[model samples]
Target: MKSPQALGLALIAALALSACQDKAAAPEDIRPVRYIVAGGQAEIGGDSYAGEIRARNETQLAFRVAGKVAAKLVNNGERVKKGQPLARLDPSDYQLDLAAKQAQLAAAESDLAQQQLNLKRYRELLAKQFISQAQVDAQQNGVNAAQAKLKQARAALDASRNQTGYATLAADADGVVSQVQAEPGLVVAAGQPVAKLSQDGPREVAIQVPENALDAVRRAGGFRVTLWKGGAPLEGKLRELSADADPATRTYPARIALSGDSRSLQLGMTAAVALPARASGELKLPLTAILDLQGKHYVWTVDDKTLRVSRKPVEVASIDSDGASIASGARAGDKIVTAGVHLLREGQRVKLLGQ
Candidate 1:
């Protein structure tokens, strides 16, 4: 019933609407990219490692003789001077042993005295022909044996007395008790640790270095420390480094001595250590960002304003464990694409992540 012109016009309008809808439904062509700004010179900084403040000397205080602990005189964190009593063992047994030894020594001395008088009388009797020379000699021998026994007994007594003295635990140096392993009423063996002492001396920072960074750490020029509570950057120097790696952590233990204004440093306080990393001549880049096409290496660099990437051919230098060194074509501060090198074409638009 409608006219032919009206029908054609309606068809045209419907086709135009469909074209506009299809255009609106098209997806965005921008590629998501991750990039890093290259560094021209390899300067190591901003690497902070968690460490602990420690004294220069840490000693394990142990008893020299085995006994049941009687009383703990000083507890953990107690400060003590040299020869200070830390704990006491039950001295009842030691005292009893000492008394027995003393009694034995006294009896031996009495026997020795009696033998000497008898030997003297035997010599006089021999001179008067009342006893044979053999008899006199035998009496002299008896006296010598008694004297030997007395000496042995005296030595035993001294040993027993020393054992009695060992019942009291004493600090060997001025220090602060860091750990207490034995308490009153606990039986401990000889040379078993009863407490740990942090000796009064220089302070240092202890840190663990991973195997990959071990060489760099050893070659570090110096170190700096910052306390966890926040303070000025204090100077530090490497004092000790382990020759072998730890079995469990595979890390090497290193000690850095605190140099300036370290009076406020406390033991066991958490700290951060920054060691200067040795710089190499060439610049470093992520190994994944490097693409090898027909033996020629290339890296995709991004333009800041256009957000577009262009493949730049680069000469390969020595490759490192973490990244490859750029010999030529790329310099520091240049923005380079780190991901999806093969999928990206030259001059393609990209949307930076988190931008």
Candidate 2:
């Protein structure tokens, strides 16, 4: 036999060798991970803008001629028909001016008749050799001048008549007077807005969109408009979009035309317009599921059969508070690792935490 110290050393070596063998034979680590289904009904958060209901054909009513407003025929919110008088200006000055033009026209007509008679007499004298050819020609020229003056006077009289009629501002179309800017005794210039008329036609919603969301708004398939006074949501289509941003607000003004049962919608009603997210059919996932490496975006997807995690490159469309909208590289029913994405490796076996 060996000495006691040697025996102890040999035993220790054998114990260490057995421990190494046991460690080598141990089972592989199976990491538990939190995961989620790639494709579901989850949608990225969309944008909403506060808007106002308005007529699609709003117009500013104004007088064609400058004058003092004598009377305002219609008040605010009054329904008016085409050709209905909205306001009246003082007719005293216009009437007096019309009278002056009429007098001038009468004088011109009388002068023209006298000139024609003188020209006929001169022609007769020339035929009888009682007057020279030049004299007859001069009389003809005088008649021509009188005829021109008569035509000018007639045009002036017509213009004056039109001015007098313009003293009464009338509605151009059937509409409701939304605003009355000119009151009785207020002097207004030509083309100044006296009232605002909302024509009876299709109703629309006007909304302001920020510059950052303009692209999404433009690409949206449709919109939903909800009224503030509690009514069913109305379907809407984008009708118009401003190319330039508003200088003061730095927002783009857009108009959405409402469809189906807009009769109850009135002008100036507050509303909200919902703009859907741009990526319609793309899959969405939590932001934590995505991994950024080497200036590229990727995600850890788990295999269904093997339960193995693998890095997948994905095309990211947009990221918001809701989640990341994936454009490609992932499909419906694929398991995606939501938590511990960075710790996972390619082809590594994993156990779903919840499952």
Name the best candidate (by TM-score): 1
- lDDT, residue 133, model 2: 97
All-Cα superposition RMSD per candidate: 4.9, 6.6
lDDT of 2 by residue, 24-111 (tens): 9999778999888766544434678999999999899899999999998989999999999999999999999999999999999999
Clashing pairs in 2: none
Return the lDDT, model 2, position 321.
61
Q: What's the lDDT of the predicted structure labeled candidate 2?
A: 0.89
Q: In angstroms, give how far residue 105 of model 2 lies from its true place.
A: 0.2
Clashes of each: 1, 0
Candidate 1 per-residue lDDT over residues 1-355, each given as its tens digit: 9999999999999999999999999986889987777773332232557899998899998999999998988877888999999999999999999999999999999999999999999988988999899998899899999999999999999999999999998998998999987788899999999899998888899999887777667777788788888878888888999998889988899899988656467888999898764364446787888988999999998898988889999987877666877889887778888888899998899988731
- What TM-score quantifies how close candidate 1 is to the native fold? 0.81
Report the poorest 10 consecutive residues by lDDT, candidate 2: 38-47
Q: lDDT for each of the candidates?
A: 0.86, 0.89
